[model samples]
Target chain A: GQQVMQIPQYQHVQEGEDFTTYCNSSTTLSNIQWYKQRPGGHPVFLIQLVKSGEVKKQKRLTFQFGEAKKNSSLHITATQTTDVGTYFCAGKKHSGYALNFGKGTSLLVTP
Target chain B: EADIYQTPRYLVIGTGKKITLECSQTMGHDKMYWYQQDPGMELHLIHYSYGVNSTEKGDLSSESTVSRIRTEHFPLTLESARPSHTSQYLCASTRGGSGNTIYFGEGSWLTVV
Candidate 1:
Protein backbone atom coordinates (compact mmCIF):
# COMPACT_ATOMS: atom_id res chain seq x y z
CA GLY A 1 0.00 0.00 0.00
CA GLN A 2 1.21 3.46 -0.81
CA GLN A 3 1.09 6.38 1.59
CA VAL A 4 1.08 10.10 0.88
CA MET A 5 2.16 12.52 3.60
CA GLN A 6 1.61 16.27 3.61
CA ILE A 7 3.33 18.75 5.87
CA PRO A 8 2.04 21.76 7.79
CA GLN A 9 -1.28 20.20 8.65
CA TYR A 10 -2.61 23.68 9.25
CA GLN A 11 -1.38 27.09 8.18
CA HIS A 12 -2.52 30.63 8.89
CA VAL A 13 -1.22 33.45 6.70
CA GLN A 14 -1.87 37.14 6.33
CA GLU A 15 -3.13 38.53 3.08
CA GLY A 16 -0.45 39.13 0.46
CA GLU A 17 1.81 36.52 2.06
CA ASP A 18 2.99 33.37 0.35
CA PHE A 19 2.24 29.79 1.38
CA THR A 20 3.60 26.44 0.32
CA THR A 21 2.60 22.88 1.19
CA TYR A 22 4.75 19.83 0.50
CA CYS A 23 3.64 16.26 -0.25
CA ASN A 24 5.79 13.13 -0.23
CA SER A 25 4.87 9.62 -1.21
CA SER A 26 6.35 6.35 -0.06
CA THR A 27 6.33 4.96 -3.61
CA THR A 28 6.89 6.37 -7.05
CA LEU A 29 3.74 7.69 -8.68
CA SER A 30 2.56 7.60 -12.25
CA ASN A 31 0.86 10.91 -11.75
CA ILE A 32 -0.17 13.33 -9.00
CA GLN A 33 -3.25 15.50 -8.70
CA TRP A 34 -4.16 18.48 -6.56
CA TYR A 35 -7.58 19.40 -5.22
CA LYS A 36 -9.10 22.20 -3.22
CA GLN A 37 -11.99 21.94 -0.79
CA ARG A 38 -13.61 25.00 0.58
CA PRO A 39 -15.34 25.09 3.96
CA GLY A 40 -18.46 22.95 3.91
CA GLY A 41 -17.85 22.14 0.24
CA HIS A 42 -16.64 19.22 -1.79
CA PRO A 43 -13.19 18.79 -3.25
CA VAL A 44 -12.65 20.38 -6.66
CA PHE A 45 -10.05 19.38 -9.20
CA LEU A 46 -7.14 21.78 -9.31
CA ILE A 47 -4.39 20.28 -11.49
CA GLN A 48 -2.36 17.19 -12.24
CA LEU A 49 1.28 16.46 -13.02
CA VAL A 50 2.22 13.46 -15.10
CA LYS A 51 5.86 13.94 -16.07
CA SER A 52 8.80 13.94 -13.74
CA GLY A 53 9.93 17.38 -12.64
CA GLU A 54 6.86 18.86 -14.24
CA VAL A 55 5.74 22.32 -13.25
CA LYS A 56 2.33 23.88 -13.81
CA LYS A 57 0.84 27.18 -12.79
CA GLN A 58 -2.59 28.67 -12.54
CA LYS A 59 -2.76 32.37 -11.76
CA ARG A 60 -1.10 32.72 -8.39
CA LEU A 61 -0.75 29.00 -7.72
CA THR A 62 2.25 26.90 -8.72
CA PHE A 63 2.50 23.09 -8.67
CA GLN A 64 5.66 21.06 -9.07
CA PHE A 65 6.43 17.37 -9.29
CA GLY A 66 9.68 16.02 -7.90
CA GLU A 67 12.33 14.70 -10.27
CA ALA A 68 11.86 11.23 -8.86
CA LYS A 69 8.07 11.47 -9.12
CA LYS A 70 7.71 10.53 -5.44
CA ASN A 71 7.02 14.01 -4.09
CA SER A 72 5.27 17.24 -5.02
CA SER A 73 4.53 20.75 -3.82
CA LEU A 74 1.87 23.44 -4.13
CA HIS A 75 2.80 27.06 -3.66
CA ILE A 76 0.46 30.03 -3.48
CA THR A 77 1.72 33.49 -4.14
CA ALA A 78 0.13 36.59 -2.61
CA THR A 79 -2.51 34.66 -0.77
CA GLN A 80 -5.97 36.14 -0.47
CA THR A 81 -8.90 35.53 1.85
CA THR A 82 -10.53 33.54 -0.93
CA ASP A 83 -7.65 31.07 -0.71
CA VAL A 84 -8.86 29.81 2.67
CA GLY A 85 -9.43 26.13 2.21
CA THR A 86 -7.80 22.72 2.41
CA TYR A 87 -5.34 21.66 -0.28
CA PHE A 88 -4.98 17.96 -1.00
CA CYS A 89 -2.47 15.94 -3.00
CA ALA A 90 -3.39 12.55 -4.43
CA GLY A 91 -0.87 10.26 -6.08
CA LYS A 92 -1.58 7.31 -8.34
CA LYS A 93 1.02 4.58 -8.45
CA HIS A 94 2.06 2.72 -11.57
CA SER A 95 0.70 -0.56 -10.30
CA GLY A 96 -2.88 0.65 -9.79
CA TYR A 97 -5.21 3.45 -10.69
CA ALA A 98 -6.34 4.05 -7.14
CA LEU A 99 -4.98 7.29 -5.73
CA ASN A 100 -3.34 7.52 -2.33
CA PHE A 101 -4.48 10.79 -0.81
CA GLY A 102 -2.49 12.87 1.63
CA LYS A 103 -4.00 14.36 4.73
CA GLY A 104 -4.53 17.85 3.35
CA THR A 105 -3.08 21.11 4.56
CA SER A 106 -5.74 23.50 5.78
CA LEU A 107 -5.03 27.12 4.89
CA LEU A 108 -6.57 30.13 6.58
CA VAL A 109 -5.86 33.49 5.03
CA THR A 110 -6.69 36.48 7.19
CA PRO A 111 -7.24 39.88 5.65
CA GLU B 1 -18.51 21.20 -13.51
CA ALA B 2 -18.80 17.44 -13.24
CA ASP B 3 -22.11 15.80 -13.91
CA ILE B 4 -21.95 13.34 -11.03
CA TYR B 5 -24.83 13.37 -8.54
CA GLN B 6 -25.24 12.03 -5.00
CA THR B 7 -28.49 11.54 -3.12
CA PRO B 8 -29.27 12.28 0.52
CA ARG B 9 -26.81 15.14 0.84
CA TYR B 10 -27.35 14.72 4.57
CA LEU B 11 -28.90 11.91 6.58
CA VAL B 12 -29.30 11.04 10.26
CA ILE B 13 -30.32 7.54 11.20
CA GLY B 14 -30.38 5.32 14.25
CA THR B 15 -28.16 2.37 15.03
CA GLY B 16 -28.80 -0.93 13.21
CA LYS B 17 -30.69 0.88 10.49
CA LYS B 18 -29.87 0.15 6.91
CA ILE B 19 -29.05 3.03 4.59
CA THR B 20 -28.03 3.25 0.96
CA LEU B 21 -26.23 6.13 -0.70
CA GLU B 22 -26.99 6.58 -4.37
CA CYS B 23 -24.52 7.96 -6.89
CA SER B 24 -24.93 8.63 -10.59
CA GLN B 25 -23.01 10.34 -13.34
CA THR B 26 -24.22 11.68 -16.66
CA MET B 27 -20.75 11.72 -18.08
CA GLY B 28 -21.23 8.04 -18.91
CA HIS B 29 -18.03 7.06 -17.21
CA ASP B 30 -17.19 3.41 -16.68
CA LYS B 31 -15.16 3.81 -13.48
CA MET B 32 -16.82 5.02 -10.32
CA TYR B 33 -15.50 5.30 -6.76
CA TRP B 34 -16.80 5.82 -3.23
CA TYR B 35 -14.70 7.53 -0.60
CA GLN B 36 -15.18 8.19 3.11
CA GLN B 37 -13.93 11.42 4.59
CA ASP B 38 -13.93 12.80 8.11
CA PRO B 39 -13.99 16.46 8.96
CA GLY B 40 -10.66 18.10 8.19
CA MET B 41 -9.25 14.68 7.33
CA GLU B 42 -7.91 12.88 4.28
CA LEU B 43 -10.28 11.10 1.94
CA HIS B 44 -10.20 7.32 2.21
CA LEU B 45 -11.00 5.08 -0.72
CA ILE B 46 -13.57 2.58 0.43
CA HIS B 47 -15.11 1.09 -2.70
CA TYR B 48 -14.78 1.35 -6.46
CA SER B 49 -15.99 -0.26 -9.66
CA TYR B 50 -14.08 -0.63 -12.87
CA GLY B 51 -17.29 -1.21 -14.77
CA VAL B 52 -20.67 -2.85 -14.49
CA ASN B 53 -20.47 -5.92 -12.24
CA SER B 54 -16.84 -5.24 -11.39
CA THR B 55 -16.85 -3.79 -7.92
CA GLU B 56 -13.72 -3.90 -5.76
CA LYS B 57 -12.84 -2.91 -2.22
CA GLY B 58 -10.18 -0.28 -1.86
CA ASP B 59 -7.26 -0.14 0.56
CA LEU B 60 -9.51 0.80 3.47
CA SER B 61 -11.56 -1.89 5.13
CA SER B 62 -15.18 -0.84 4.95
CA GLU B 63 -18.22 -2.79 6.11
CA SER B 64 -20.35 -1.22 3.44
CA THR B 65 -21.16 -3.00 0.17
CA VAL B 66 -21.75 -1.57 -3.26
CA SER B 67 -23.58 -2.55 -6.45
CA ARG B 68 -22.93 -1.57 -10.03
CA ILE B 69 -25.72 -2.79 -12.21
CA ARG B 70 -25.57 0.20 -14.51
CA THR B 71 -22.62 1.92 -16.05
CA GLU B 72 -23.62 5.31 -14.69
CA HIS B 73 -24.84 4.27 -11.26
CA PHE B 74 -22.99 2.99 -8.19
CA PRO B 75 -24.73 2.68 -4.84
CA LEU B 76 -23.22 1.96 -1.43
CA THR B 77 -25.28 0.22 1.25
CA LEU B 78 -24.55 -0.33 4.89
CA GLU B 79 -26.41 -3.39 6.16
CA SER B 80 -26.32 -2.15 9.76
CA ALA B 81 -25.28 1.38 10.49
CA ARG B 82 -23.50 2.48 13.65
CA PRO B 83 -22.42 5.71 15.26
CA SER B 84 -18.96 5.15 13.94
CA HIS B 85 -20.34 5.35 10.44
CA THR B 86 -20.86 9.07 10.76
CA SER B 87 -18.81 10.67 8.01
CA GLN B 88 -19.03 12.23 4.57
CA TYR B 89 -19.17 9.78 1.69
CA LEU B 90 -18.05 11.12 -1.65
CA CYS B 91 -18.84 9.60 -5.03
CA ALA B 92 -16.55 10.11 -7.99
CA SER B 93 -16.23 8.99 -11.59
CA THR B 94 -13.46 8.91 -14.13
CA ARG B 95 -12.87 7.97 -17.75
CA GLY B 96 -11.06 4.75 -16.87
CA GLY B 97 -7.44 5.75 -17.12
CA SER B 98 -4.63 6.60 -14.76
CA GLY B 99 -4.17 10.09 -16.17
CA ASN B 100 -7.83 11.03 -16.36
CA THR B 101 -9.35 13.49 -13.94
CA ILE B 102 -11.78 12.21 -11.33
CA TYR B 103 -14.98 14.15 -11.00
CA PHE B 104 -16.57 14.06 -7.55
CA GLY B 105 -20.18 14.60 -6.59
CA GLU B 106 -21.46 16.94 -3.92
CA GLY B 107 -21.07 14.07 -1.39
CA SER B 108 -23.46 12.48 1.13
CA TRP B 109 -23.00 13.37 4.77
CA LEU B 110 -24.23 10.55 6.98
CA THR B 111 -24.67 10.86 10.75
CA VAL B 112 -25.69 7.70 12.54
CA VAL B 113 -26.73 8.04 16.13
Candidate 2:
Protein backbone atom coordinates (compact mmCIF):
# COMPACT_ATOMS: atom_id res chain seq x y z
CA GLY A 1 0.00 0.00 0.00
CA GLN A 2 1.06 3.60 -0.64
CA GLN A 3 1.16 6.13 2.18
CA VAL A 4 1.75 9.86 2.33
CA MET A 5 2.70 11.52 5.59
CA GLN A 6 2.61 15.22 6.41
CA ILE A 7 4.66 16.84 9.16
CA PRO A 8 3.41 19.23 11.85
CA GLN A 9 -0.18 18.01 12.01
CA TYR A 10 -1.04 21.46 13.25
CA GLN A 11 0.62 24.90 13.30
CA HIS A 12 -0.05 28.32 14.76
CA VAL A 13 1.82 31.46 13.79
CA GLN A 14 1.52 35.20 14.12
CA GLU A 15 0.43 37.18 11.11
CA GLY A 16 3.21 37.98 8.64
CA GLU A 17 5.28 35.04 9.86
CA ASP A 18 6.48 32.33 7.47
CA PHE A 19 5.23 28.75 7.59
CA THR A 20 6.11 25.50 5.89
CA THR A 21 4.60 22.00 5.72
CA TYR A 22 6.40 18.91 4.50
CA CYS A 23 4.92 15.84 2.77
CA ASN A 24 6.59 12.48 2.34
CA SER A 25 5.45 9.40 0.50
CA SER A 26 6.38 5.79 1.20
CA THR A 27 6.51 4.97 -2.52
CA THR A 28 7.56 6.88 -5.60
CA LEU A 29 4.82 9.02 -7.10
CA SER A 30 4.04 9.89 -10.66
CA ASN A 31 2.69 13.32 -9.72
CA ILE A 32 1.86 15.33 -6.65
CA GLN A 33 -0.88 17.89 -6.01
CA TRP A 34 -1.62 20.41 -3.30
CA TYR A 35 -4.97 21.55 -1.97
CA LYS A 36 -6.47 23.88 0.64
CA GLN A 37 -9.70 23.60 2.56
CA ARG A 38 -11.11 26.48 4.54
CA PRO A 39 -13.10 26.03 7.73
CA GLY A 40 -16.19 23.95 6.89
CA GLY A 41 -15.45 23.96 3.18
CA HIS A 42 -14.56 21.31 0.67
CA PRO A 43 -10.98 20.88 -0.52
CA VAL A 44 -9.87 23.10 -3.40
CA PHE A 45 -7.03 22.35 -5.73
CA LEU A 46 -4.09 24.74 -5.56
CA ILE A 47 -1.34 23.33 -7.73
CA GLN A 48 0.18 20.20 -9.22
CA LEU A 49 3.83 19.27 -9.65
CA VAL A 50 4.89 16.47 -11.97
CA LYS A 51 8.50 17.02 -12.93
CA SER A 52 11.25 16.01 -10.55
CA GLY A 53 12.78 18.79 -8.48
CA GLU A 54 10.02 21.05 -9.69
CA VAL A 55 9.23 24.33 -7.98
CA LYS A 56 6.20 26.51 -8.51
CA LYS A 57 4.94 29.66 -6.84
CA GLN A 58 1.69 31.53 -6.50
CA LYS A 59 2.08 34.95 -4.91
CA ARG A 60 3.33 34.25 -1.36
CA LEU A 61 3.05 30.48 -1.73
CA THR A 62 5.89 28.25 -2.98
CA PHE A 63 5.70 24.51 -3.75
CA GLN A 64 8.55 22.07 -4.29
CA PHE A 65 8.78 18.45 -5.37
CA GLY A 66 11.75 16.31 -4.38
CA GLU A 67 14.01 14.97 -7.09
CA ALA A 68 13.00 11.44 -6.29
CA LYS A 69 9.28 12.27 -6.31
CA LYS A 70 8.99 10.89 -2.80
CA ASN A 71 8.43 14.16 -0.99
CA SER A 72 7.03 17.66 -1.38
CA SER A 73 6.68 20.88 0.58
CA LEU A 74 4.59 24.02 0.69
CA HIS A 75 5.94 27.32 2.00
CA ILE A 76 3.93 30.42 2.73
CA THR A 77 5.72 33.73 3.08
CA ALA A 78 4.22 36.48 5.21
CA THR A 79 1.13 34.57 6.16
CA GLN A 80 -2.20 36.31 6.45
CA THR A 81 -5.46 35.63 8.22
CA THR A 82 -6.95 34.45 4.96
CA ASP A 83 -4.33 31.71 4.91
CA VAL A 84 -6.01 29.95 7.80
CA GLY A 85 -6.96 26.52 6.51
CA THR A 86 -5.82 22.91 6.18
CA TYR A 87 -3.12 22.24 3.60
CA PHE A 88 -3.08 18.81 2.00
CA CYS A 89 -0.59 17.01 -0.22
CA ALA A 90 -1.75 14.35 -2.69
CA GLY A 91 0.14 11.88 -4.83
CA LYS A 92 -0.66 9.39 -7.58
CA LYS A 93 0.85 5.92 -7.41
CA HIS A 94 2.59 4.03 -10.20
CA SER A 95 -0.66 2.26 -11.03
CA GLY A 96 -1.95 5.59 -12.36
CA TYR A 97 -5.33 5.08 -10.84
CA ALA A 98 -6.50 7.64 -8.28
CA LEU A 99 -4.90 10.23 -6.08
CA ASN A 100 -4.03 9.49 -2.45
CA PHE A 101 -4.05 12.35 0.03
CA GLY A 102 -2.05 13.09 3.14
CA LYS A 103 -3.60 13.72 6.51
CA GLY A 104 -2.90 17.44 6.05
CA THR A 105 -1.42 20.22 8.18
CA SER A 106 -3.88 22.59 9.76
CA LEU A 107 -2.58 26.16 9.75
CA LEU A 108 -3.89 28.81 12.13
CA VAL A 109 -2.75 32.37 11.59
CA THR A 110 -3.27 34.84 14.40
CA PRO A 111 -3.33 38.54 13.78
CA GLU B 1 -18.37 27.78 -10.27
CA ALA B 2 -17.61 24.30 -11.62
CA ASP B 3 -21.32 23.38 -11.61
CA ILE B 4 -20.87 20.44 -9.24
CA TYR B 5 -23.97 20.14 -7.06
CA GLN B 6 -25.00 18.03 -4.06
CA THR B 7 -28.52 17.95 -2.69
CA PRO B 8 -29.66 18.23 0.93
CA ARG B 9 -26.74 20.23 2.30
CA TYR B 10 -27.60 18.73 5.69
CA LEU B 11 -29.41 15.55 6.66
CA VAL B 12 -30.47 13.85 9.90
CA ILE B 13 -31.59 10.24 9.75
CA GLY B 14 -32.13 7.52 12.32
CA THR B 15 -30.10 4.35 12.52
CA GLY B 16 -31.14 1.40 10.29
CA LYS B 17 -32.62 3.73 7.70
CA LYS B 18 -31.53 3.66 4.10
CA ILE B 19 -30.41 6.95 2.58
CA THR B 20 -29.03 8.24 -0.66
CA LEU B 21 -26.92 11.31 -1.28
CA GLU B 22 -27.32 12.76 -4.73
CA CYS B 23 -24.43 14.29 -6.67
CA SER B 24 -24.55 15.94 -10.08
CA GLN B 25 -22.09 17.93 -12.15
CA THR B 26 -22.74 19.95 -15.30
CA MET B 27 -19.06 20.20 -16.15
CA GLY B 28 -19.31 17.01 -18.22
CA HIS B 29 -16.27 15.63 -16.43
CA ASP B 30 -15.89 11.91 -16.91
CA LYS B 31 -14.07 11.47 -13.62
CA MET B 32 -16.03 11.69 -10.38
CA TYR B 33 -15.03 11.01 -6.78
CA TRP B 34 -16.62 10.80 -3.35
CA TYR B 35 -14.69 11.67 -0.19
CA GLN B 36 -15.54 11.72 3.49
CA GLN B 37 -14.26 14.30 5.93
CA ASP B 38 -14.76 15.38 9.49
CA PRO B 39 -14.70 18.93 10.74
CA GLY B 40 -11.29 20.50 10.14
CA MET B 41 -9.72 17.16 9.22
CA GLU B 42 -8.29 15.07 6.41
CA LEU B 43 -10.29 13.80 3.43
CA HIS B 44 -10.70 10.04 3.04
CA LEU B 45 -11.56 8.87 -0.43
CA ILE B 46 -14.45 6.48 -0.20
CA HIS B 47 -15.27 5.91 -3.85
CA TYR B 48 -14.52 7.10 -7.37
CA SER B 49 -15.57 6.56 -10.99
CA TYR B 50 -13.58 7.17 -14.12
CA GLY B 51 -16.77 7.32 -16.16
CA VAL B 52 -20.19 5.83 -16.46
CA ASN B 53 -20.35 2.25 -15.18
CA SER B 54 -16.83 2.53 -13.78
CA THR B 55 -16.59 2.68 -10.01
CA GLU B 56 -13.85 1.73 -7.54
CA LYS B 57 -13.31 1.83 -3.81
CA GLY B 58 -10.66 4.06 -2.32
CA ASP B 59 -8.06 3.73 0.44
CA LEU B 60 -10.67 3.89 3.17
CA SER B 61 -13.30 1.23 3.40
CA SER B 62 -16.85 2.53 3.47
CA GLU B 63 -20.28 1.11 4.11
CA SER B 64 -21.67 3.12 1.22
CA THR B 65 -22.20 2.08 -2.38
CA VAL B 66 -22.04 4.42 -5.36
CA SER B 67 -23.45 4.37 -8.88
CA ARG B 68 -22.32 6.15 -12.04
CA ILE B 69 -25.09 5.35 -14.46
CA ARG B 70 -24.72 8.69 -16.21
CA THR B 71 -21.65 10.74 -16.96
CA GLU B 72 -23.04 13.73 -15.09
CA HIS B 73 -24.35 11.92 -12.05
CA PHE B 74 -22.71 9.87 -9.28
CA PRO B 75 -24.67 9.12 -6.16
CA LEU B 76 -23.83 7.27 -2.93
CA THR B 77 -26.21 5.08 -0.96
CA LEU B 78 -26.03 3.78 2.59
CA GLU B 79 -27.97 0.56 3.05
CA SER B 80 -28.01 0.76 6.82
CA ALA B 81 -27.07 4.04 8.38
CA ARG B 82 -25.45 4.22 11.77
CA PRO B 83 -24.15 6.88 14.12
CA SER B 84 -20.68 6.06 12.87
CA HIS B 85 -21.85 6.99 9.36
CA THR B 86 -22.25 10.57 10.43
CA SER B 87 -19.77 12.63 8.46
CA GLN B 88 -19.54 15.12 5.63
CA TYR B 89 -19.47 13.67 2.13
CA LEU B 90 -17.98 15.66 -0.73
CA CYS B 91 -18.49 15.07 -4.44
CA ALA B 92 -15.97 16.12 -7.04
CA SER B 93 -15.31 15.89 -10.77
CA THR B 94 -12.46 16.57 -13.11
CA ARG B 95 -11.83 16.70 -16.86
CA GLY B 96 -8.68 16.49 -18.98
CA GLY B 97 -5.74 14.41 -17.77
CA SER B 98 -4.53 13.39 -14.34
CA GLY B 99 -2.86 16.78 -14.02
CA ASN B 100 -6.22 18.51 -14.11
CA THR B 101 -7.71 19.74 -10.85
CA ILE B 102 -10.73 18.25 -9.11
CA TYR B 103 -13.70 20.53 -8.54
CA PHE B 104 -15.70 19.77 -5.41
CA GLY B 105 -19.28 20.32 -4.35
CA GLU B 106 -20.13 22.10 -1.10
CA GLY B 107 -20.70 18.67 0.53
CA SER B 108 -23.53 16.82 2.23
CA TRP B 109 -23.54 16.64 6.02
CA LEU B 110 -25.20 13.44 7.24
CA THR B 111 -26.01 12.62 10.84
CA VAL B 112 -27.51 9.33 11.95
CA VAL B 113 -29.21 9.26 15.28
| lDDT tens per residue, model 1, A1-111 | 788999989999999999999999999999999999998889999999999999999999999999999999999999999999999999999987677789999999999
Q: lDDT (0-100) at residue B92 of candidate 2? A: 90
TM-score of chain A of each: 0.98, 0.98
> For residues B45-74, could you state the per-residue lDDT of candidate 1 as single tens digits?
999999999999987899999999999999
lDDT of 2 at B40: 78
lDDT for each candidate structure: 0.95, 0.94
Query: Where's the lowest-lDDT run of ten residues in candidate 1 chain A?
Result: A92-101
> What local lDDT does model 1 show for residue A105?
98
Task: List model 2 lDDT by residue over B1-113, tens digit each.
Answer: 67999987999999999999999999999999999998877889999999999999987899999999999999999999999999999999889476678899999999999
- Considering every candidate listed, which one attains the maximal lDDT? 1
In model 1 chain B, where is the ten-residue run with the lowest total lDDT?
B95-104
C-alpha positional error of residue B101 in candidate 1 after TM-score superposition, expressed in Å: 0.6
For residue A103, what is the lDDT in candidate 2? 94
DockQ for every model, please: 0.82, 0.75
For model 2, what is the C-alpha lDDT against the true structure?
A: 0.94
Candidate 1 segments exceeding 4 Å error: none
